[model samples]
Target chain A: MHEWTIADNLVRLVGEAARKEGLTEVSEVYVKVGVLRQVIPETLKTAFSHLIGEIEFAGAELKIEKIPLAVKCRDCGSKKAGDDLAFTCGRCGGIDLEILAGDELYLDYLEGKGNGE
Target chain B: MKIAIKEDILKEEDRIGAENRREFLARGVAAFNLIGSPGSGKTSLIEAAYRELGGELAIGVIEGDLASDKDTVRLRNLGLPALQINTGRGCHLSPLMIKKALPEIDLAALDILIIENVGNLVCPVSFDLGETAKIGLISVAEGDDKPTKYPLLFREAEVVVLNKIDLVPHSDFDREAFYSGLRAINPAIGVIEISCRTGEGVEEWGSWLRERVSSPAGR
Candidate 1:
């Protein structure tokens, strides 16, 4: 599954962040996943746990924040957060819409014990 | 202690993709990533393009499949410079794969490079392979609801190639519904309907390729 691929990237990013922060043990990792990405939270969590099990951040809590799809209509200039995949403007019935968010996949922050703590 | 690290998970991949873009620009090669579902006529469209524009443009291909080099062999049989990447269990082709394949091809000798991604809609759309444009291919047999079902692919693709148009009459494929779905996701996406088997719209597809190769913008 693509979850494995995403988890691999997440591990690398987390490792790099840990190194920069001098974290000997990471306790929690916060990530933002967009709804448009179609990523299953449960699957991603499983993948993340599987990948981090043997690392220094083995027991780190993977916290995921799902971001809803937000778009701005070019015709009516209306901003809307949509749950469905219609992708149409809610107010103006326009198809020309600019995506404002919800396509993101990123690590927001992390909490951990650093060196000499 | 808390460490603030707001970073895109695919930052490294994007960085490599940017490097690939620069390399393509330096070589003056218009590269296009062709993505579609299995049995959506991706290989056939490549063959059709080879037949139509092979003589006019120096076209090279990079075929990405799970475990076979059948597509690479097919293109090689036609005497096209082709390379194949077997992703094994990977569902999509990553920028790293593209980076490795780049050295195998003589970039300076080609005007166009077409990377045929693994036959997957969801995973491949998220990964950029440093191509000039991403082409989403859907056939009439796949139903008109594809754009709505897989919005990201349609939203990200520069153009959507509707292949197997000859089967439109045989199947109950609604063209208006398809266009409406595409419009909702990507209003400005260029659409070219073609039947590779019958060569119905190969000329238009070839012209689109030619324009992309000739234009400095490579839109």
Candidate 2:
């Protein structure tokens, strides 16, 4: 499994998002990581830990939201979670399907000390 | 009343990366971050390319690997200016690493600098390397589902090379699925199928590389 390196890169991304949202003191970061990505959560945590000191997400919690792979059948228009890359239409048994979910890896929202809600 | 410098770190990093790229371009050096899965022929392609075009082009390489200088040694054996970065246990190369490694090499002398990123399909795509292009290598032996399954690399790549095509006669890779998936996700991306070993489609790849980097308005 591959983990995003440069340790500081993820920290910077989380820190920037926090600043823009004014959730300067992020208590938690909600990241949506796709299953297809070989991102190891633990390694990301380790990278984040080393990097958080340089930015606003310092001491901030990292919350990972794992997104499973989902596909929408182009043949029959049925939306379903992909099964082992079968990615076939559930209703019509057609093999042509378009991926609808599970390619995402980004910061979504923050639970923070200053979340304006 | 805020005492903290509340910031999204990625944005800050990207800001720095942009500046670095600007400086690099100003110096007339174009960089490319080459990424792919292990055994996808990332290094071999670079060696093949240098042997064919190195004399005409002043090429320099930065090799990223988990713990060995084996790949870097290969590049050096070719007599190309090579820098080996031993990442110990790290999985991918990031902009910061490039920025750190840039000073070691004479960035001003080369027309192109190729960064052979750690061999992985996913992690390497997320990081920016202050490069003009991100070329992803996918071999036929890895199956055609790679583009669809690993969408991030596919989406990030400016050009995708389906390497080792000569072996397709013996493999079960679905070519149609590969093309369709890439087209659906990234219509603007240029696709080239080549056998790095037999030199089957390298002329096209080299031509494509030269074309993109030499385009009048290219950055």
Candidate 3:
């Protein structure tokens, strides 16, 4: 699954962050995934669990936040947010809509024990 | 202790993609990434374009597949400069791969570079390979509802190529539903129906490529 690729990136990013912040052990990792990405959380979690073992932060917990899809209609200047993938404007029924959000895939933060702790 | 990273996951890939884009722009080469399902005729479409525009336009190809270099051999046999990237377990092609492959091709001598992405619709749609445009391919055998089923590809693709028009008479593929579905996601998306098997509608696709090559601004 492509989730493996995403998980690989997550592990690398979290590992880098842990090293940069002088973190000996990463306990929590927060990630934001948009609906447009179509990443299944359970699969990504499984993938991370399998891959994170190779790194220093083997037991890091991944917390994923799903962002809903939002769009702005150019014709009628209406904005709509939905969980579905329909790209049509709900208000004006226009097909010319600008995507406002829901394409995000990023690491939000990392919580862990510092070198002294 | 919380460290706010706030970094995009694809930041590395995007960085390389931007670099690749700059290189293409500098060389005045129009690069197109072709994405579709396993049997959507992406390679065939490239072949058709080569047959039509190869004499006048200097064309090259970067073929991506899960394991084999079959597509590369096919293109090379036709006297086109071709390179293959076996992604192995990876589902899509990354800009880093393109960056590595670019050195092999003489960009100054080529007008168009067609990249045949690994045959998966979902993963490839998200990865940017620094192409001038992404051409989405869907065949009649895959059903007309594919556009709605995979809206992101339809929305991101510059033009949707409807392959296997030769099978339309035998299959239950509704052209009307396909057009409407594409419109719902991308109102201004261009569509070209072609059957690489029968050589139907390929000239139009060739013409589209020629126009983009001549006028990179139009891409």
Candidate 4:
């Protein structure tokens, strides 16, 4: 599934950090995923499991937080939680909304001193 | 051993892409990432562009595909700095590939660098290559509901070229619906109806291209 592909991205992120900073292993990885990104987390974790061995990120834990679809209505200027992909203002009929959150894909940090390879 | 470091991985990709864009802009060169589906007439449009402004404008192409360099050959035969990027089985082109290929491009002398992305509407919209404008190509035969079905790509595009209009008569689709759908997603987007085969609206696209590629910001 595309979820596994998403995990590959996470693993790649961690692997890159590990390789560049000169680490033998990674301990933890934190990510923020927004709902609007249309990505599934379980598949990403599964992909991470396989890719962990490539850069000595084996045994590293992946922590992710899902960001809700928060949008700002253009007409009312009120920020609200969007129900789904099709965003509309709940307070007003304004359909012009800006996404405030939930399209996030970031690697917050890494923790570990990998043995010198 | 436990070592804690703070980083954002997505930022890294964006940073690299931003850096590349900065470098081009610094030298007064602008780049466009061209995207669309197979047989959407991207190569044809490129050829038409070559005919119109290829003489006055200094253009280069980075063609991305899973296997063939046929498009690359076509572009090269016309005597331009054209390169082919074979992605093997990859569905889309990444900024990393562009970074690797930048060395072959002389940004100082060129007016435009067009990256013809793999022929897919879905995956390519997600990646940013530090392009100044994303030119979304959609043929009339592909169905006018495309804008509604692929809102992400339409939203990402600065200009949407409804190419291959000559075949519109043979297809059952609503052109107005396509425009309205796109406007619903993005009102400010520039829409041009063109047919590369008959040179219809090619001048309009080329004229718009000339203005952008010849601006002070562009080399």
Residue-level lDDT tens digits of model 3 in B175-212 = 99999888887888999999999999999999999988
Q: Please list the residue runs of candidate 3 whose C-alpha ends up more than 4 Å from where it truly belongs after superposition.
A: B217-219
Ranking by DockQ: 3, 1, 4, 2
Q: What's the DockQ of model 3?
A: 0.76
When summed lDDT is taken over every stretch of 10 residues in candidate 4 chain B, the lowest stretch is B1-10
Q: List the RMSD of every prediction in angstroms.
A: 1.6, 6.2, 1.4, 4.1
Q: Between prediction 1 and prediction 4, which has the larger DockQ?
A: 1
TM-score: the better of candidates 1 and 2 = 1
Candidate 3: C-alpha RMSD to true structure equals: 1.4
Per-residue lDDT over B99-150 for candidate 2, one digit per residue giving the tens place of the 0 to 100 score: 8888898988987888999998877776677888889999999998887777
Clashing pairs in 3: none
Q: What is the per-residue lDDT of model 2 for residues A1-117, given as tens digits with 9 covering 90 to 100?
A: 344443354566666656775674767666777766556789878767666766756787666777787988776788878424444465886666677877676666666765554
Best by DockQ: 3
Local error of candidate 3 at B91, Å? 1.3
Among all candidates shown, the one with the greatest lDDT = 3
Higher-lDDT candidate of 2 and 3: 3
Ranking by TM-score: 3, 1, 4, 2
What lDDT score is found at residue A60 in candidate 1?
86
True contacts kept of each: 0.79, 0.17, 0.77, 0.36
**Candidate 3 chain A lDDT trough over 10 residues, lowest sum:** A84-93
If both were scored by TM-score, which would come out higher, candidate 3 or candidate 4? Answer: 3
Could you tell me the lDDT of residue B184 within candidate 2? 56
Model 2 lDDT, residue B216, Cα: 19
